[model samples]
Target: MKTYDAIVIGAGPGGYPCAIRLAQLKQKVLCIEKENVGGVCLNWGCIPSKALISAAHLYEKSQAGAAMGIKVSGVELDANKMQDWKEGIVKKLTGGVGSLLKGNGADVVNGTATVVGPKRVDVTRADGSVEQFEATKAIVIATGSTTIEIPTFKFDGDTIIGAKEAVSLRRIPKRLMVIGGGVIGLELGMVYQAFGAELIVVEALPELLTGVDPDCTKIVERKILKRGGTIHKNAKALGYEKQKDGSVGVKILADGKEQTIVVDTVLVAVGMRPSSKGLGLEKVGVTVDQRGFVPTDKFCRTNVPSIYAIGDVSGPPLLAHKATKEGEIAAEVIAGHKAEKDWVAIPGAIFTDPEIATVGLTEAEAKAKGLEVSIGKFPFSVLGKAMAMNETEGFVKIVADKKTKQVLGVHIVGPEASTMISEASLSLEMAAFLEDLSLTIHPHPTLGESLMEAAAHAMGAAIHIANR
Candidate 1:
């Protein structure tokens, strides 16, 4: 049997990073993965989804290039070709991850590993080969998450499918019904909608992207409606019945009444659940929460001293970046370093049409905390860059404390909103006040200037908004 200083199970965004960090710390680390090295983010979720969205954006712009005397003739999208290209990108990225791991001198084992105890892991290889890994110091679990299935809606991987299958549809559905209006649902829905599908989304909440800023979500909902997508919220999808002709009949409760909607395809994007099963947690005396999330302290360390857990399996804000940071922290702690996991500003970005991003608390979250707050707004419609791009579909919003002027929240919806949220995140991290951001000398004629404008408005000194 082989022994190592640390052994990480599941080579994913969380696990792979932890493995490499430990190796860099001069530890003999063995990382085990049952599937591909890059896991779902590169293999399925983040990379492929973004590629499809990029294609959708290009297609959208090409369709409207004729407005300024720019002659556009024939433009059409081949779904199969796009899928092939997306697959190619995923392969390249996953391959890069494998190379990075090996370069760090981390042994990448190909098998399913189970924790026999705090110090042992049984690696079950393919072809019925099995071996055991005895960790001399620590073991980390970063197995990640999976999509939850609706009670009565079964996934057929063709007709009714999960986001995995939705990524790989050979042909676009004439009428697509996406259940749940969260990030995954809206993202994939937009891709198909941009490709000219009669898309309808049914969510259980009162509105789409419920936890996000309400006004901003309303703006996104309007944009989606303008793009010919239908939304049904506060609706409970009870079950589904397959028709004789191979169509799907979705039944839901809306406004205290039963309603049935038929569609060619159904995409379930309810939410993600932690993959805490079959890891032999019970054998190690490790306890999981009722929802299957591995409970951990602030350092990503579980109840056991020599064992740790991070990422989606550790719960909420199951983002790849969050997992990545937590993975780095856990590695440092395991390598006998003094480290603390504390991030005041964890940013959240949604890649919808008019992409939305927010850092720290929302307006409601701030109000709930009983803080006297003043909010500022800067619409992208007035920005030169936004208008020049012909993508003036969003705004920048800032929330600051009424007394200290310390920024508490930053929300944005527009082009490059995903990239812009990082500045807000850093400001919140530094506990930056309104003046700190507003007086930072933002360059002219740029989308980033909108952030400065929003901060200026929070100080009641915006030049863009007259009479502020």
Candidate 2:
């Protein structure tokens, strides 16, 4: 048996970082992976999807370049080339992850791990060789989650598919139907929509992006409508039938009516369920919740002190960055350094058309908490940078406490909203007040200036837009 100070399973955004950090703390750490180094986030989910989205966005921009007085003809999309370029990026990134692990003095092993005891793991390698490793101190589980598949509309890997196949499609379908209106569905659906696919989105929920600020979602909804896409909310997809012409006829129930729509492809992006079973968790007496999530304390420790869990396997807000943060915290705790899962907020960035990013509380959430609040908004249409880029389609919204004037939340739906939300996240983490944001000098004519102005507007001191 190979013995180590700590053994981290599932070299994902969560597990790998934990191993690296443990090594940084001079702990003997071994990171095990069943698949590629970066897990789904790098190999199949975030990185690949963003590459496709970027290509789609650039292709869309090329078509609209006439507005900028640039007359370039023959705007075409080479799907094969785009896919190759995306693959190149994935290869480089996964390679970098492997190098980082080795450079940080963590041992990397390729195998599927099963917990046999509180701190003992049995790993089966590709060649059917089994090895047992003992973690003297801790064993971290970070298996992440798998996409949920609707029984009726099973992924055929061609016609009816999940987000995994959706991102790797070499040819854009002429007509695409997205089964969910959440982040993954909308983001990938709009990518193909930009590439000339007539989109039809059917969401079971009453609204698209149920948790996002409605005002921001409204702008994205309008853009989908303007692009000739159809949105069906409060709807359910019962099943899908294969058509004679190599397409699919989907059956949907919406507004108490049944309808069938034919489309070239159907994307099932309903949600993800944690990958918590088949790991002998029950044998080790680790408690998993009803939803299959492995419950962990602030230190990412399970009921068993020797065992810990993080990322999607541990709980909600299944984001890569959140997983990474938790990984570092867990590593620190295991390394005898004082650390816990303590953070003001975990920000979210949606790469939909025009983008949407948010940090901290929404207005409704603040109101629901019975806290008096004030709102400030600034439209990108009035911003010089947005006008120069000819992508003026959304706005920045700031929510603050009425009495304390402390910044509670910041929401943005505009160009580069993903990049802009970082500042908002730092503000919330630092517990900055409205006056702190407003008084801070921002670079002139930048998208960040909107955040500063929105804070000013919250205090009735806005210079650009009419203060409320």
Q: Model 2 reaches what TM-score against the true structure?
A: 0.99
* TM-scores of the models, in the order given: 0.98, 0.99
Backbone clash pairs for candidate 1 read none
Per-residue lDDT of 142 in model 2: 91
lDDT of every predicted structure (CA atoms): 0.90, 0.94
Clashing pairs in 2: none
- What tens-digit string does per-residue lDDT give for candidate 2 at 155-178? 899999998898899998999999
Clashes of 2: 0
Candidate 1 deviant stretches above 4 angstroms: none
Tens-digit per-residue lDDT, 255-350, candidate 1:
899989888999999999999999999778898989999989988888888889988998888898888888899999999897767889789999
